[model samples]
Target: MKKVTLKKNLSAAMISLLALSSFGGTVHGESKTGINADAAILVNAETGKIVDKYNEDQPLGVASMTKMMTEYLVLEAIDKGKIEWTDTYKISDKVYQLANAPGLSNVPLRAGDAYTIKELYEAMVIKSGNGAAIALSEAVAGSEGEFVKRMNAKAAQLGMEHYKFVNSSGLSNYDMLGMHPEGTGVNDENMVSAEDMATLAYRLIKDYPEVLKTSGTNYKYFRKGTDEEYLMKNTNALLKDRAYSYKGADGLKTGTTPFAGSTFTGTAERDGVRYITVILDAKDQYGQPSSAERFIQAAKMLDYGFTQYETVQYTLDDTETKDALPVQDGKEAEVKITVDKPIKVRMMKKEIKQAGVELKLDKDKTGEDGKLQAPVEKGEKIGELVLKNEKEAEYILDGLQRDQKVNVYASSTVEKANWFVRSARNIGEFLKDIFG
Candidate 1:
């Protein structure tokens, strides 16, 4: 059997489903008690398909959510062998200034204190530490200015066009509190569109899956090496057993600032379908004391995704041929074609039948027996296959504006016959002409 690792998504806690009977129409129109956000989006993590979208293109200040990129770049540096888990970075005066700054989201760090890769990463991710973020930025690129450049470059590389990062920590330029480095050209808070935010989180999870190990941890301690330890609470309230405890919610990040209000990128998985929700600039709950508006909106969006749509995974087996084609002038009479690799197509269960899933052969390359000629190699291009419903196809062709033209491949190989085998065909042709 071919080796393929499929992590089951459903959990026992998900057994008690929240029957979103009231907020069903929130996706289409605004509700008084629905997701209170200026922009929001829920995406199918598997297919990159949008389930619910509201003003997702409008760029808004992302605040601490910027750490997602910060964390990603750190992990990427480690992956590239430029850094290591044991490597330590000393806290600089700039880092201490930010950490001690009034009202900044950061753990207290004294100047010259050193933190290892694992410790600082946990503080940055779980505590949303501005100090840790800036420290890592300096360690990675030698300066916050250079790190911000890399951040913007990485965003563009990931196709996140609607993103701008001016600082490692997502603090606004206006809210700098005179803590940024002298003559630093930083002039803006982090800005990101909902769609781009989800794309960033999706890419981060896909590329560095180990991020979940820290992002999912609910609590930890920073400065474990010293007595000045600070308790770090995972800012993502959706993951905790709170009023909006989403069963499968693991992480991403959350941000709240007076100007940005609240921002969040939450990730969850249920029944094989992974969901990512982005909410930016959410309304602060009127009279509610806690900073839970983002978490509530994230939970509502995730619940809507899980209940409104059912995902079906179609096993795209590339090893076995669902159909075979007869070969000509070859050692073998036929050749088998299939998908080139084991893949899964996750889509709305309702779209399965109407998805217009048709398996077509490369007719232009076929032989007289309606099959490709011999000498066909395994995994050779044969044709095209699309897992799409009418809406999906139109979305790609029109509004959603996706360009995906992929080719299907053959599953097996076939070799050509030698000269003696060609003589047999020549003899048959000669006999047929004589009889005629």
Candidate 2:
């Protein structure tokens, strides 16, 4: 049986979930709340904030959504130059056999048949072709087992502690005893948490925007030989029409199995903001539309995000500067410190007045003289600025800390202070100290 591993990395925003016991605040109810799947998560693609969640950290059979990881690994290979769009891969017997396997999605490649890496990627993502995934794995790593090692390793690297992979095709069934009574362990499947799936989806699109170009394609055709051409349609019906369209609802992966249920990683972008939603065990039967329920949940969460929260730049304006620190043994007497950017937070319009900034400094670095020494670089750490509101104490804070020792680099004349001049100055200082 195949084995696989995966991990999750929470962004600072999502890390805030640790502070809240639940994300159901304000948003409630079975129908209105964004919790339609057995496991679901809606996170800000850019900020990684948990907008809504239901059994998000719970591990469940993810079915074809396992292909999201496969897609991730493939894009990584392409980004790192291990594979290229134009590169051709020779079909192997293993992949060919899997392609012909009943109930498996495949691109129908025969042994010795070749297709470009780009074409295989489209088949895997657009058509949900398991055989295409196996072929790509072999092409990049020489064997399905070895590629799976890479998959698990990558998962660990991504901090997805709850995931494990058994095969490139996600067909392993080692843990399906309760779900499948036929005693078939051969269908070794890939597993991951809803949070981990969202993490993978975010990273894939953020790192390899090109994958979207292929995943968003609604249809494609590949020729295996002069006489045979396989016309493939995208398995994601959501992409078929404009009726249920959501802006930036681009390419992503979906999956289903009798044991795993319906699962999907759906990504959408609007007004420069991107969001990733993961739903696991969303359906009661195969080839069903239960995954769409999660999409509705995602839309609600995203709408709330855009309308309820606002990102503000809080850079230190000159008008806000209370005072400048003096510089000793430097051409300039002082330097200005300011906030880098405005922070974003969710709040009601009436609560805007409650937002304020607090500045602090490193106590050890600040001298009693209240002046910085020479050789200060531009944009050097001088102080930290924290932004907070009444409801949430602190929403965002810049890394810069107060009293952080800053250099005051000498100007043109000071730059000419050579070793002799420095030594002469040191000798004069020593003589003055002894006399005193």
Off by over 4 Å in 1: 1-34, 181-187, 284-290, 313-322, 326-337, 340-343, 367-381, 388-390, 393-436
lDDT of 1 by residue, 155-261 (tens): 98887756667888888665566655333543445667787888889889889989988998898877666688778988888776756778888888988765456
Please report, as a residue range, the 10-residue window in candidate 1 with the lowest summed lDDT: 3-12
At residue 136, give the lDDT of candidate 2. 86
TM-score of 1: 0.77
| Candidate 2 TM-score, true structure as reference | 0.71
Error (Å) of candidate 1 at residue 395 is 9.5
lDDT of 1 at 322: 49
* Per-model TM-score on C-alpha atoms: 0.77, 0.71
Predicted candidate 2 versus true structure: per-residue lDDT over 261-329, tens digit per residue: 667777777667776777776643443436565455555655665666565434344224444555445
Candidate that would win on lDDT: 1
